[model samples]
Target: MEISKGQSPHTQPNMRTAKVYTALESLLCVNCKQQQIIQNCESFLKLDAQLRNKRARELKVCLNCLRGGHFLSNCNSRSTYKKCHRKHHTLIHLEVNKANETIPIPQQIVNENTITNTSNQTNSTTNLSSSTLNAQTLLSTAMVKVNDTEHNSHQIRVLLDSAFQSNFVSEGLFVPQISSALPTHTFNRNAIEIPPNIKLADPRFNESRPIDVLLGAGIFWSLLSVGQVKVNQLILQRSKLGWLISGELVNQRFISDQTRASFFSLNELDHKLERFWQVDEFTSNDHILTNDEEYCEEYFRKTTTRDEAGKFIVKIPFKASVHNKLGNSYDVALARLKNLERRFETNPVLQENYIKFMQEYQRLNHMSNIENNNDNAFYLPHHAIIRESSETTKLRVVFDGSCKLETGLSINEAQFTGPTLQNDIFSIIARFRLHQYVFTADVEKMYRMVWVHPEHRRYQRILWRETTNDEICTYELNTVTYGTTSAPYLAIRCLIQIALDNQDYYPLESQVIKEDVEYSQEYSSLPSLDMSQ
Candidate 1:
């Protein structure tokens, strides 16, 4: 209508409700008095709700004009705005220049029953002269006919929904489901089988028929090759659900299908995933904690019990392999002793780190000498290697338990290879991403934090030199030694044990660590290791 109200004077009014003004043509007739006809009609306006409520009993207010004692037609506000068309408001003439516009059904095709029933019940009817419906046609149904080469042509009622990417037919249409995972992502997972067909569908005018299949973007991509093909007078045009084929083709390429994603298959290699990769730079922080006497004493107290003689006996088990390499390992240890002496002479910093390392080793009681050259214990051979990294200036010493004898049997060969104890890299990255802020710290000398049983310490001996010219000395390692096959197992198991032991102090972090460590073991085929302290 020619609505002149406030800032938006030229805006159209809704015609269905009596609360708003009707169009100029609906209000005026050439032979009739327009004022007298509209004065009796009700009016609607965007009035101050409080003002209307205060004057509700006394004032005969015009809701369209927001004035007292008269209706919209009798008010002066309706006469100020101009009309572009004689039959309708100026706002109705604005056109949308889009590729897909809703096309209305012909008069003959629209069910007579719908019009008669609507008019009789609600006094509502469609504009017969108008050739289009609202763009959002909720009842978007279609009749799809399968033109198959191998099977007989069949028809199915389909709903063209663009929300999903894949086409879906009833599970009854396909054979038994395969053992492999289905390609479709919907909750109703079913097999994807191809029917050799050139599908054609007539957008159904009625919403009565139930949809048997859903034609998604997957089906739309196949129709791109057909290009503007027609069925009778219907030509393809884009719609929200997909293309609508009802009018003549305006151009050879009606609309581009760039919105749909192109699908592809993964190669055989891509399907085989071995381990997760991490890109974060991890640095060792082992250099700062040179004094480990306190750490060693705590582990000793937690892991040992006093015997009748008041001696600390380690309660942990020491499992060794059947193969023995004591002889060859001794030879390697002697050679490494010479190399260590030479390095001590050349590098003063190494001498300091070595002195501190030995101090902590002695305080921890990591090894003890055989009494009076006793032959009862196994004299395990050990060799030392220097580790230098960007994280630390001083080189750290690591013992080698893999050195073999003439029989080719070493400590690593004789010990249990232990279960996989580390968490997968992907899970760590995922958890890191979950929190807003993150910090990571490495455990210093993690392997040396755990102790070995006094009996098992006999198999973890090492050779050392107090001075460059001093006689070589032998000491059995009373702690888990690095470079051994079972070392990782023993260390990781101990770490988990310590976490469990202190879980009550930091419940949340401990629970997370425990769950992460146990998750793989529960799902994997590998035998679960006993990690109780």
Candidate 2:
């Protein structure tokens, strides 16, 4: 049976008359949704093939997201994705996109405990994820097998050592003691006081003491205070005992031990005694008055002393006293003139003209002295004298000469040794000369003024004591005496003690004045009168 174009198969005329047409129309019903007529069948078949292809391209259930069937949204597994949002949840599957290429099935999730157990039997077969690994899993997998029954403590220690190698614990961090419950003990908050009488062991004093110890300790303390020795580290140990040193014990050490045990001990005592006696601290004015009184007393005591013959005795011999007095006068005159010259040199206005005048005056004076001595055969007498004291009948002498006469002579060669002696004699003579004062004094017996050391007393011997039958023996120097070659040197040294003690009589410019007289002819013109003449 042939159907017309665009005609419904359901309404087509009969194939074997009307009966065949009815059977074909029943087979392809128009209202039935599942069945299709022969003409519409090609369209329905094309649509079914397209739907099947789209479903094939869609994702299977995610296994992570259990709800959705296609991809994560269509996933049906609920147990696999349980508690996925929790903090400790292990992430197993990871999809990585590289350069716009989709990598399929990148990772698989496995329980850590299961992996640890399975790793014992077959080391290679267990496909375990790394993200779910705990410290136990790492220890079991990398260090030891779970099936191993015995393990060495050293291996565990090595593992622990390596694990903590990168983590640093601060030195100051405190760890609380939480092993047992115990009441905490609180320290006393109040300050404590200490008494003054307490004594402590001074490390300085412990080292050494009367003479040797004292000197040693003095040296040690001096060095320690100045940082030459690290006393803190030497004496202190890193313990509770060191902490005790921070309190009153240490304070007392510095106060009592340091002060009373060191160099300050004698000085402190003297100061205390002076305060107690005077009711006030001693001042410069007090020292000056006391010194003056002492000088007068000493002078009177010496003047009152007499010899066996009942005559007043002088300390300095007459000859030496006169010479020193005259020498001092000349020294003063010369110094005054020299000082004026120095002032002139330093003066801006007078320097040029004054210097020329000074030179000419000096030249003339020098020429006059030479001409008088050479042409007239006039020699200036050495004005010094030696005399015998009436009472003691002992020889005495005086010094009278220009300090200038001693030019080019050293103190060692002339009259003295030691800085103290040189400074003292020069100071004494200089002050008297500068003030234009003449000293009228006598040496009792110049030689006798010095007491020889007992060990050296035998060096002084007299003929009467050695050979004469006379019961009374006189003392005479067998070694160099005060008037001999070495006399000046010894006298100068002896004079230093006097000079330092009696500084008021020995001014500062004594040596300078003597220097000018000895070396500079310019000083010779200054007005000078020697009473020793």
Candidate 3:
């Protein structure tokens, strides 16, 4: 790439740089790119510096790659012209663009699921890498305005998935039966520049809103036709749904020569979880979830919703089918309540503490009054675990999730106990050494933060009375019952979700919360406390 003149614009053009740049413009594979280097070699060649630089700048292509729409400072391209390595392309000298100033190419992040699912072995890279996962996974998303049952239009964020086979709607959205905000309720959304006079399908294409509807391949191509406007890597095309943007976005913010991403395989976590939580029997070495755990997740996706107050609402994952609905266990619950009363009569202090606990629950609106009907009812008998040594909670009430009826079926037996979704304590503890600054915080009423579905609340009923003088009252736990098998999974899931949704603003803290935090507490080991802000 050595030229006779570095600053002379009248000098000869580098044929090798031209050929290589042409091969790159053609979108050649790595092998072809290598062949491009082999077939056409670079000798002493030079092009007009001022003429070329002006032309390159006008075309908005980086001088290094001569393809990507960027300045020489942000070029991610490299030259292989017989190992004649210079930051800039051979045709354009260093002084032509920015004198000796090299801008590193920004990196793209691969889908976490892609990396996790492909690799299963423990010895770092044990899992199969289907492809180079260094690139970001881009989804074609748009803010779609759809009319509800009342014919009022509301914007719901949608994902245009051309590879998917079907469409889906999130039950969390307050849409009419037909379908599917906050500090971000109204923010300055990012706007992608579209072609003039082209009516955009969705004006707010860059808002970070929740995905409501997922339109698959069947509905994708049908919406888009021949109309397309290119904006760098992004392609804005007209569609039946609206104008949608596809492809990656370049952000100079993350440009760095090095990207240190710790790819902790989910399989590794599963194995570590097994070792951490000792079991009598060995788990399958395949690093896949059990049938019961898989079923629990599938059920959650199909039935989960969000109420007005922003709490995650979930159904009790009942194993019973349509034909095998179990009868009410009211009589059994009544007998247990009577026995509990007898114990309270002897220990008035215990009863007083328990009553206060239940009162606090009612005050927080964590339980609701439900009609005492025998149909499809399963009352959970409860008792208090009094730890006098404990200062904060001397009397903690716990529901008897395993209380069985005459039919020999208990709530625990009839429902799925979802797999542990939280990172093992061992791993979180191990991460403490990675950073210099660390802090921990306990989440208040963690299990009470998540809500259970109203329809399925009947299955979580309990019997209670202020005193023996008062009549027995039936109440269903509105929040996730603490003793229920699925409670941990549900509550931990919410914590993880909070971290994920806010990662854009609080990346380091969110990472700690999502991957490092325990069930109800956060032990965030950050590089510095400043990052938590």
Candidate 4:
């Protein structure tokens, strides 16, 4: 005990017994507010105080331990015992009574069902292993009616689970009421034959009803299982319900279907092949030929286009011809001119068509004459060829850059062939079959669609005139011309650029058409290129 705040350090002893008691009482008086007495060591005074405090505060106590600080729900006790009608945490008879009266036992006895190997009673007291408890906890019950006899049909609870490989019913259901509905095949466990769809009687569930059957995967793929469902006034879509269905059940729901018109048939493929063999009649307005020489001349004056020097030019890389020729041999150019003139004189149809073709070329400004004194200009050998086309009279002009010179160097030899500029043909064909709707169109005058660099244009000089009476004039082809090895590379490269530049304007269409483009070289090795590329 503490003495006094200002007293001596030692406490004085009392000689008399009564005096000792009085002194002890006096010592207790010191710091009375902070003092307490414990009558018995086992009293657990601190615990008593806590209980008292909880009672005073009117706090809840755990039903299991009848102690304060937590509710029955949060209690950590795993012990279970039988009481009124089911398992409980406390013994009713042993609990404290409010009136201190004699406890009277109820007439009804509560039953607890324990899984066992022998007894078939629905509810009976029996020892249960932890595994049994766990299994019971994991099971979910649903009420269902077994199709037995018309007069004996009864509703029972069924376990809906996927653990069992097949569906099963209680063997007790083998009674006359459901015997006729049962199938011959049965499920056996430990030499016992259990009937399908009718098993021995089992306890029913209490939540909604009693459990009677175990529904397994055998019937999961059947109509008994629902593919679509809705609840709580909200519609459930297939995507949401698919999780509940077995993979096999879901897969069985769909079969292969190829009835759509979009499916290309063998006949359609044959037709496509036939079309490939036919002449390509498709023609562009810019390259259309006419029979009037005057009309052709006027068109040339109106539509000729040119590119600014060095601003936007395609680079061409070609190995110099062994001949080392810089310009068209004048003799060769003159010979080609005379050959065309003689053909037109003999074939009137050729003369008229030739005039129209020249006029159109002039209008497009595809060709222009170099200054008479421009000695630096390289002359390109030109020739006219006639071929059978599905459309108008056929005449195509080609530049013969391959002509050999005395030194073994030709125009084509000096130019660059550029890189492999086309896409793989196989890739184009693959994506072509991907879409339901397909569209195809050819670029008119595909090679001439691009302009040559001004510096390079001077090397593409050609000899042309309106008629035999007209003076022979020198002109440079301003665009990529046919018969030039670099034409395909230049045209394809330009096409790729155009598609990339306009992708933002037509994203979907651009992606689809881009797959159709066929380029040359390296393409055959790229087997992974798809529509996106």
Candidate 5:
């Protein structure tokens, strides 16, 4: 008791910590007011967390040894809370006073149903209160680690629901893909200072980005730990996902009147959800092609031609007339490359596969080093996606044609997202089962086989470096870049044209290529071995 009550911080670390916390839990930042390094405050917070953890051990005093001679944090005794799973026991003492005094017991026990009703009322109250916002209250947003199909944890931004309500997610959000882009979009960090050694769930937490997931009741509670720190209105809570920050910001400019109106309600979110599902990626012959698509088709037919090698050469269908307005994208692409390097550090095999893919791309004359810079060039940001189930390739390079820089310009944005011209996947599968002998074949580097016109090759420039020590070099992709929106259309349309040109000579084969092949993948069935051959 005397040791804990010591006046000097050197005697009792808790005394100093108590003072630091009291000063921190204010409406404004004390460190900022004193013109000190904000990081110093964060450093102190780390120290505090470490100290608390150490103290937690001491706090778990042996209950059975209370009447014993010496004090110990833990013991061999098996006494515990059972539910907590920790080596500590909680003793609740109830006092029975005079005969007239009754035991302090609740009138009713709150079951799951009663608590659920209370939650409904709480949500209703919250909704009612949300109409009038005198001041802004920032909700807890975190970066949670979600496992992909390959068991790799991808950091996804999620809302930490303190209210412990139901989770809201669009269907098929969790369908693990081989790879996906990060920071979907970057946001501005307005005077926000994060401490060193503290890994945030989302590195760009202060920035305004779309919330990818919303964690509810059970998950929200499970994510919490005993570690927490407060900087003025901003409070950081450590959790399983990482450190989560909530409360208002110090900068008023961060939240303006214009942006305040941008917050979405449940109704608005539902409308977005409907629109999200309505945007079909597949376009079949069942629906008439749009005007832009038809124009793209005509452009392909008029400009597209086969060389002596019978290789189809097509130009990128650029819908935007303002090709001159795009800004320099080399730096943006380089940044993404560096990011990819950091990701590859953990998996050397993925890096090797990526390097081989790029090397093969260059060796096949699909891409060439740029000797002269093009006035209208776009450098694509590339990353690797691991598909363990893939028979041909486990790791494939995915170029982000839709990757935009500060200028909000990208290859996909400039070019038309040409219509999906192939038959439905269902139709292809149905036709495969109809034949006695079914065979499948993938067109090896099929997209690479189709060359991009020299005029449009300038728009498909990419940056790459085989090794980290090597200098990054810019190269033009001579082939139809797989990532571009119209590449699929160009590849599939070329096959259709080939079938048309050879229809009279090889009628049956031409017919099979035209009808049965779906974007270089021949998933067809033949009745007999002779026909299959």
Candidate 6:
């Protein structure tokens, strides 16, 4: 028999082959139990290459068999029989198409019992169709429920759950309740008041007590309250005997109305205060001697004698202590004087009457004193003479030990040269005067008492040596020595302290200066004299 146009050889029931084909011809759709003719079957193929081989081996099965539509024992025979019948029916349907005659399957039965049964089956199919419907029925049901009034009550609950999960609530939302439970009070702002007496205590009050008294009270309070300035200890123990009120109180505030009036009235006090810390007029000069003619003539006549050569040599007591400490013979001091004359030849000031007196004194007594060994007649150079005695020793040691004179001349000579120099010298002299009266102090072993720092000690070393065990030992400074950068500064520091300690009794009269050293007392005033004496 010839096969139809759309049929493949695999579709023929008698043509069985072991090779499977995925084409439409090889398929037998078990759903309708029909041969998969080329016109009736759909192609079964994998879209991806990876699944192609697996899909080729996959056996196509019917969905009805998977759902247990037929008895398992009779499935094979039934499937075969259905396939044959379908093919025959399709062929008949096609042949009838040539005659254009329409034929329908028996969808209705004529028997009454059969009609009832068909109705039941129809109802059953309707139910089955309802079960298989898409999401439209579920959506309609949900819409009806949402329209109910009872469902609106859940909206707030849903919103709260969403907010909680999102964590949008503030942390302090509940804190006020706890704090409110603990305390309950209202502040009466109008009831609080400041007192009139306390208002007077304010520092800004214009009509308050005199500034000096106020400052004095403040200082007293400060001393008492802070326990730093012990007035009782100061009085009893005498620890602060010479201590003066200085700093702000001494400078800006008045100790009394009288003090204030006095301070403001006079130019002298104003100048002194302004220049209080300035060096004295006397000590500012490098020289202690003056240019007064009569003074110089008298001093020269008293201190000098002429030699055969008419050379004037100074005559003044040259103490053994001065000679010993200076480590120089009398001849050296004499030579130095000659050199000084040569060096100062052009300085008219040095040739003033006072200096001339000194020159005459030297010339008159020089030869006689040297020959006769008259200790009182022979005068030593200022640099050569060392002050002795306990009082002078201590003062000299403290001041001269640290202070270096200028290289060219004695402190006295330098002082007479200029006003500024005079001021500095006077300042130092004032300090010394203050020290004498206030402290009632004496010099220690002077030069021997001065102690130089080890680092600076080398600067004071002398070339001379002493023989010890027949071996020479170089001489080094046994005490603080002059002629170093730090010396004058150290001396001024000591002098200031001494002046402070003695301020109460013999307050500084003038400032002092050595070379460049200067000292001034900011709080200095005229001390009351003991007129009864």
What is candidate 6's TM-score against the reference?
Answer: 0.17
List model 1 lDDT by residue over 195-219, tens digit each: 2242334334322344567767666
For all the candidates, what are their Cα RMSDs to the real structure? 27.7, 42.0, 25.3, 32.7, 26.1, 47.2
| Model 3 regions more than 4 Å off | 1-287, 322-328
lDDT of 4 by residue, 1-533 (tens): 33323333364454222222244442221112223322121222223333433432353445454444576678777665554332233322332233343332321232432333334422223342211011111133444554432122356655555557856566545322211211111212222222343322222221223335666767433423333443322222222112121111112212222121112224556677666743243322133334332332343234333355421255444343422345446656666666667666777776787778777887888777655433555566555567886364388766777866555567666655544433345455555565554545556777766777676676677777768999888887878877776677567656655666679997755554454555421111122336324
Clashing pairs in 1: 19-44, 44-63, 44-64, 45-63, 321-414, 321-415, 328-405, 366-478, 460-477
Clashes of each: 9, 28, 11, 46, 0, 62
Candidate 3, position 435, lDDT: 87
Q: Residues 119-200, candidate 2, lDDT per residue (tens digit)?
A: 3432222332222111111110011112111111111110111222232211212322211110011122121231233222
RMSD of 5: 26.1
Off by over 4 Å in 2: 1-444, 465-480, 504-533
Q: Which is the better candidate, 3 or 4, if ranked by TM-score?
A: 3
> Which candidate, 2 or 4, has the higher lDDT?
4
- List the candidates' TM-scores in order: 0.36, 0.17, 0.46, 0.37, 0.56, 0.17
lDDT of 5 by residue, 1-533 (tens): 12223456465544632332343333332323333432233432343333423333444423432212234454656665554455432221122333333232222231211212243322211211112223345567776666644344456668777575777653336523311222222335545566777777666665556667777886889878888888777788898877877776544333322111222235556677765754544334466889998899889988998899889989888876745566887777777777777767887888889989898888889889986474667778777787999888887887788776667777687788777766777677778899889988788877888899998887788888877899888899899887888888888888788888989999988877876787878988989999866
Worst 10 residues of 4 by lDDT: 129-138
CA-lDDT, candidates in order: 0.47, 0.28, 0.66, 0.48, 0.66, 0.27
What's the candidate order when arranged by decreasing TM-score? 5, 3, 4, 1, 6, 2
Which tens-of-lDDT digit does each residue in 1-533 have in candidate 3? 23242333654555322112243444532222433431132221222444445555665666676654467787666553333366655444433112234322112122332343333354343222322222222356666777643233456877787888988887545442322111112223343455677766556554445567878899888777777888777777777766666666555432323323444445667787876665434332234689988988788778887778777988877775621354557777787777777778778898899899999999998997766776777788888887979768888999988765656667777777787876656567767767898778888889998888888887788988988889888998999999887788888877777777789998866777777667787775778677767
Find the 10 residues in a row with the least total lDDT in model 5.
Answer: 123-132
